[model samples]
Target: MWQIAVVLFGVANAVQVDFRPYDHSAELLFNGSDFNHDHIFSRQELEQEFQKYDADGDGRVSRHEYTTYVTTSVPELHDFAHALYDDYDVSGDHHLDHHDYDMYYAKLDADSDGSVTRQEFVDYWVKLFQATEHLHGHGHSGHG
Candidate 1:
């Protein structure tokens, strides 16, 4: 689903991929900066995110609770997290790797801003999902 695609995009962008042909930008991204894209989130940004979700002032988010909240809230991103856990959790460690993060980062950060602002990330995926959803919803009506 769109959720899986979006998360994959984000994680991929955060991690660099080995390019065989080496297109212009892919070459740059593959070799550029840290090649790990560690600058995805600043401490300020993470704190802000925590503030946004930690509505009860509990100062913590458990894995189950956080996953539910995100999935229910977006309705589209639940599949994304699931896919991330499935594909990129290479060692079955139930966690993401820097390579995964780099790959996701590159795909989502269209503007190459070095950081994915939330709105940018959402907008990028929203358009992708909507377009794909329309294509999926299309039917020939048995008339074609």
Candidate 2:
């Protein structure tokens, strides 16, 4: 029951989606700089990043843990981060397990066949990067 305020490109009206923790988690994969401007994350990178937040060593990042991650790692998103976690409790089981993570990836399944191919996954992240770049105006900022 979290509402994510998303501004659609080329649309005057804004829409709210059932914001999920995966959305914020995925968004955080971008570096917003020269280090990883393309937002291309290899499997190892994803695993390493996930491992950093999966504090309990339970192979899952719960809502409380994700909230802490967002507040500390990406404070800019703190205001709405908790809502995203709440919305992701798809099973009403109160925990975001591996199935929830897989479901998030399944969302990028363009063909809607219940799985994401390598191309689809890559393309989705690329498109996300491009859109972010566009929204931020043209180029990546460098820390010199």
Candidate 3:
């Protein structure tokens, strides 16, 4: 049942986009799952997000750069932001755009609700980062 959910969740997240999970073992970060760690948002995802949020096309993001992240009683918006924030803030720029937002929102909104909530953040991250249980140990264990 859990495995089914994982597969379905992945399929759902990638509804309209073509996201290829990278070779995570190659990078050795091991967010506790998969060779690509793509089940969660990968660096590729962050870059894409950066491009999206960089509204000025300046090629760099300013700190706390404001953008839209809508919410409703339906939930999912907050959850999507939680899942993506730190990760998508590549170069530590600390901001995101519709590209990054949409990418992760899609991931969290596995059922395609057009929004995300806090619980979805925990659930999706748990599956992508913990469900596969790919972590090994210490400062780094899987790298070779």
Highest-TM-score candidate: 2
Off by over 4 Å in 3: 1-97, 131-144
lDDT of 3 at 30: 28
Question: Residue-wise lDDT of candidate 3 within 38-125, one digit each (tens)?
Answer: 3454434434535544557776544333223212221222333343355554334465544545555576656676544334444565
Report the Cα lDDT for residue 77, model 3: 29
Candidate 2 Cα misplacement greater than 4 A, ranges: 1-49, 73-76, 113-144
Least well predicted 10-residue stretch by lDDT in candidate 2: 1-10
Residue-by-residue lDDT tens digits, candidate 1, 33-116: 322345344323333443433445565433444456556635444543354334323345443334444555565567886676
- What TM-score quantifies how close candidate 2 is to the native fold? 0.44
lDDT of 2 by residue, 69-113 (tens): 765633434445554555444465657766655555455567777
What TM-score does model 1 achieve against the real structure?
Answer: 0.30
C-alpha lDDT of residue 8 in model 3: 15
Model 2 has an lDDT value of 0.47
> How high is each candidate's TM-score?
0.30, 0.44, 0.28
Every model: Cα RMSD to truth = 13.3, 11.1, 16.3
Q: Quote the positional error of residue 32 for candidate 2 in Å.
A: 9.1
